[model samples]
Target: MIAPLVSVVVPHYEAPHDLALLLTALELQTHPLDRLEVLVADDGSRDAPEPGPRPYAVRVLRQADEGFRAAAARNLGAASARGEVLCFLDADTVPEPGYVAAVVRAVTAGADLVVGRRRHADLSATAPDALRRWFGGQGPVPREFDEPTWLREAYERTADLADAGDDAYRFVISAVLSTTRRLFEDVGGFEEAFSAYGGEDWEFAHRCWLRGAEFRHVPDAVAWHDGPDFAGRTDDAQARRSRNVEGLTLARFVPGHANRGDQLVWSHPDVVVRLDDTGAAVADVVASVRSVLTGSDAGVWLRDGAALAVLEDPRVHRGEPPASVLGRARYRVDLERPVVLTGATLADLAEVAPVRVGEHLAVRRTRDLHRGGPDPAVLQVPGVTAEPAQDVDLQRRWGHEDHQRRPRFQRSLRTPFVATERPTAAP
Candidate 1:
């Protein structure tokens, strides 16, 4: 198979010394040199970054000097990228010779999102040539030192994140990551709103999660960050305050466990399933809501205002359309008809929810509801099981059977909206 071109986007501020070291390391990558394209995304530095002499292709992209805008800078790099896969790296992080190859292997194996292992070292005293030698294995492996133990444990426990939940994004880091340019642009690129030092990566990861992008941890693909981790950077009061603000901003934007502490104030709902009475008994609706609520902490949006007064449940939200209530939820389940849900349904949803992209998980559908008619599904109770509904038309889609289906579906989970056509390539 022909290897896909890999665009390595390096986010550089004013660190010319560190940037040069990183670029030198890139020149030694085990991946085919012809397939590698290096882009130095300069964040409005006073002096432009020079990638130094290189046999392979290298480009420098610069934007106006803005306060910490790594998110925007990375977005710019992605927009300029012509490769099928985009690999992101910080200016100070230098990768081992095999890093690029490992990233390519992961993507070719069906991983849309991949994070390489990042190890930390105090390269402040180390010479640039020595650093290059260490990365090339010509010198000692720069003193295998302390790294994020928690992060290492997470990948091991999750089996390289195959079993990770929607919340697993917390473990992903932008220091070393790779994904298809198509998927990156499809998810609306990184939110440029983040102008601070942190949280942009997590926010982007959360968005990718919503779109069903697969996450894989490539531990063998080592990249040595030039300095200590963020925690070791500074412990002053101002740094603490800035970190707190970044955390809160991330909570407000990213839903689910990531934003669990700010749930009441946050607009996004974690799990949303709409319930319309149609012709089903109010008792049936209540029972359905109960089953769902019991299974998970999903917010139930009631279509029948009259039923809202009767249910009197705190979890039941009724002020607006289900989509609006969901805000930016990654996925929303629509109950076309009222049917008693089993614990197994909730269990199945939890498992299938993370990997579902461009498709909805279907449980059974009624012929009447399939035709955009009212709920004709009969609820089964006690020992008897309800016969599965057979609606051949339902096979075509997952949501409202009556509503005209769109040619394209938006990755947005909140505020149910569909794009007429998939967004054009990232600009």
Candidate 2:
């Protein structure tokens, strides 16, 4: 088919160096410049960038300062876009030359949505920068290809594809997502409720799911992203994210990611609280399979001891332990926690932190704790009905390398690939 009109939508803020890299990459695209429309929405820059109208035919849309947000800007850009497909990018990301062309190729091949492969960027040696990188995988550019191409492209003709069942979330990340403009509007676009950052893509993806749009992972369409941004993650950011998280609870646990008792619930055995004065005490566990996480179960468990302390807190649930939380309590486990809970072997131990049900450890599995269903909790617990069992080695090596071996992706992601080749495109 004739090349579909394509528009690249960008929301840039503080990091100009990364913006420069993204611009440079796009400038080298093999696709014809005339068919491409690059619209950048400056989401309230602290200071306007000096580069004025120059060689390339890019349109810069400016707005008042509104706290480095991109969702509103995206809505505005999409409203005015003429391209058949709209692609979004962040400031600190660089797309390869063939990225756009690859996106179009995927769309024409019958995929409703296409996502760009993302690789972690390299970091400067400054101490602060290094710490930031470690927490968010914000280091130097990754040496490996962001993703493989064929895996992304073959999803088209879904029947031929071996298992579209696994890769069937029809929504891609706005960082480099493309779908027909028509479909985007039909779904009412992204929810402006998700202001500054975090989970907007997921919200929009869920919206698309509600509207019946299909998405695929396009690996060849690669870009380098500046790790995940926790810069704006203050109390307000978290509150907003939590609000969205709550609203999307049903969407999250059902359908695509149906409840599968993730790590948060399944790995309860790894965490135990012993409040005995001297082998003559009671216990309270901070984690549970499905009940609300009010400090009740744990509080009840803690009241029975002379001194209650935390045991295994690989991931801190709430900020620091509250001083007024019943008795004088302190953290127990040291170092980091393992990542045994979020794997595919979904487990459900009634209550991860077992409750004293009668004389026996009366435990009840969560409502949606099985695999192949909508899962509520982030960590996938193994859906075994048996009582929770502890792994001694897990307890021993709690923080030994911890989750360092796993790639630092806070969320799940798929790699996707391209359709046509343009001579001007660079690697």
Candidate 3:
């Protein structure tokens, strides 16, 4: 079968250090340089755009200062392309060396649109890696390519188009995605009408799926994303998020969610914290956020997973898995014997005792970071881990690695803190 020419199109705006990393990776793709073209679309940055040259043979193009966002930039690159597959990548992401060949394989093996995985590359902000712990959240998003056997098969078996909105949380980021030129034009090209802060990809993909394009995750094709630098602050950007929520987009795309409260903590951009847990108390918290999350689009217990789907937040939805152990939806505290999950590291502990969790004065009571999600059950009982030695194995993600026989954590359980002790309290 004749292979299709692939275009590795990148959209850059005042970000070269990150862009260079992306280009460097493109240079290493297993696919021959002859079969691939790397093009950079300079979105009219204030400084002069890099006139990319040899080594990578990258084509550099520019557009007027219309502020159309990465979407517009990709459109411009596609307009000048000679490839059949348009591999759209954000400027800050570095594709894995095998990316091109993987895309080619998946597409030829039959996926019309293949989405790759994104791992967090750098923490450009102070304590970014730390703060990520404080909130019990992950970073750089967890792009659902986590386990792709299902993703690959789904795409190949049916030509039916898939969309992020269909799974909203997992389909989260538009970070590393590949699609055909046909899928591009039929979607009407990123809705130039949806100005600013970029939800255009989701909106555009929604349209394409509506038009008959298939989407899936390509596990082996990966990218390293320099996670968003929110500058240690949340501001007007929160307001701008409404721009994407304005049109009937939410009405049609998001089910079970309502307008956010006048202002809600943890309701930051690109990241979402949707509460799909309809358990008794879970529904109460859902009512609390009644202002923001609404609709028939909500996931039911039997349909959605067991407890809280962290993938709900647009940020987390797009695979920005919480950064530190504290950030992980699955409990990522980094060290042992202490409660500061954020500052903890590989040398530190991933879980702590109930007393340690409660002893921390910052918390007043226990509440799951997942809100209407699963409960971590932190409580101030000393016997669970010692004296009254109740044995609970620290759960580990299924890995191909063997187990080392050292108690991951050993301490007297004392105070009650977040994620400790599920309530048997009457609803």
Best candidate, lDDT: 1
**Regions of candidate 1 where Cα sits further than 4 Å from its true position:** 140-144, 236-239, 272-331, 335-427
**What's the C-alpha lDDT at position 164 in model 1?**
91
Q: Write the per-residue lDDT of candidate 2 for residues 1-427, one digit (tens) a residue.
A: 4677788887777666666656666666767767878777777787765434433467777677756457787887777778989888876666767788888888887766677776554532223333334334555434333332443455554542324532344324577777778778866776565554555675565445434455666778877665533332348877766656544542332322232232333212212232222332212122221121222122223323332354443322323333222111111211121112222112123224222222223222221112122322332334422122223243334466564578555453564333466678566
Q: Using Cα atoms with residue i matched to residue i, what is each candidate's TM-score against the true structure?
A: 0.69, 0.48, 0.48
RMSD of 1: 15.8
| CA RMSD (A), model 3 | 21.4
TM-score of predicted model 2?
0.48
For candidate 3, the clash count comes to 58
lDDT against the true structure, per candidate, is 0.72, 0.50, 0.50
What shift in Å separates residue 406 of candidate 3 from its native position after superposition? 70
**Model 3 global lDDT (CA atoms, 0 to 1):** 0.50
**28 Cα displacement, candidate 2 (Å):** 0.7
